[model samples]
Target: MKGPVSALGINLLGNNVEAAQTVIWTHPKKTEDIGYNFTTTKTITREELNKISKYIDDKDTSANVLAGIATTILTTPLKPYLSISSGIGVTLLTSYRSTNGKLVSDKLKKSTAKSFKVKIAYKYRQTGSNDGYYFIDTIKIS
Candidate 1:
């Protein structure tokens, strides 16, 4: 028997056929935003720090400061039982104090970095009482 003249001839004799084209379909991806956490470093100039210190000192005597103090007093009694919220109240009260501002300014004044890391947490709405939205859960500076 003679060998096939060509591969194309062999394919033709076998009645074999090949696809001439191909098609594909794709869809866009969807994303859901539930929550996120991130850390960012912020630089503060001496002038800015001084201004911030002054602002805090001024606010220290404001009604909000009194409210914070009252909140602390009311929450301290429940601190042992409800540590989370009570601790938050105490932290808020301390944050509104000139002493805290002085301490922070002094500490940063001695350092060359003059920068702080801010940790921010965000949360999405949970229930039907309100529309879905994002809000900051907490901001911690170090």
Candidate 2:
């Protein structure tokens, strides 16, 4: 296929791609189904944070939301689109205060981790066709 590269945009550790009707699998007699799946997330490390900060040197803070919600979105990326790629995302809770004014703490029962997944797709097109790019298979590649 040669129209545009595509991939499953959002991915979790273990979840269906979309509203699953059913996925049928049939191996062509002459070809091997050489596709596999895996997952990765935006589990941040102190070193990574340091590197990021050091590179930018606090130059721009206008779009620093990623740092705030990295842990939540780390396991997901933008939904499928042109030139598909992987990324991390997160859903952040502003504070540990419960709706009823109860206090919660990260050390007690909160997870501050974020992550997303990367999927590798096999983009292909017919020998002379550029408008029919298709993905024969896709696998997770951290």
Candidate 3:
């Protein structure tokens, strides 16, 4: 059994499908201010893990770290945001992306010593796949 410390944290971060379609979708100059939402202290199920493993297996590669996983309703021109929102108490940074090109991943830098204020960026999916979402690199508390 996994301990409470091992529970998976999932954050929706942000959904910008509408924003990106309009002229108001101003790209952030810093890449950190893109509209994103966040969540922490989540639990990952075995089925989810299996799915992830299969995805990796199909790619013939292995990964030791992942931010999070999400799904969307569209296949193209979709932008999803995933972030920890603040850098408070972040200790490490690791990232991995699905080879299928359906997942967007990010990791914080090891130098992250403060809570994340909020990181924003556009998440584009595969050319013809309907996978859109940003996974958190880590969990941060303010």
Model 2 error, position 18 (Å): 20
**Total clashes in model 2, counting residue pairs 3 or more apart in sequence or in different chains:** 21
| Candidate that would win on lDDT | 1
Please rank every candidate by TM-score, starting with the best. Answer: 1, 3, 2
Off by over 4 Å in 2: 1-113, 127-131
Superposed Cα deviation of residue 98, candidate 2 (Å): 40
Global lDDT of each candidate: 0.34, 0.28, 0.27
TM-score of each: 0.31, 0.20, 0.23
lDDT of 2 by residue, 1-142 (tens): 3322322223344665532111112222101223232223344444434333332333323335435433322223323222222221211111101111222222322334332233323333332322332332332212
* Model 3: ten consecutive residues of lowest lDDT: 85-94
Top TM-score prediction, candidate number: 1
Q: How much is the lDDT of residue 25 in candidate 3?
A: 19
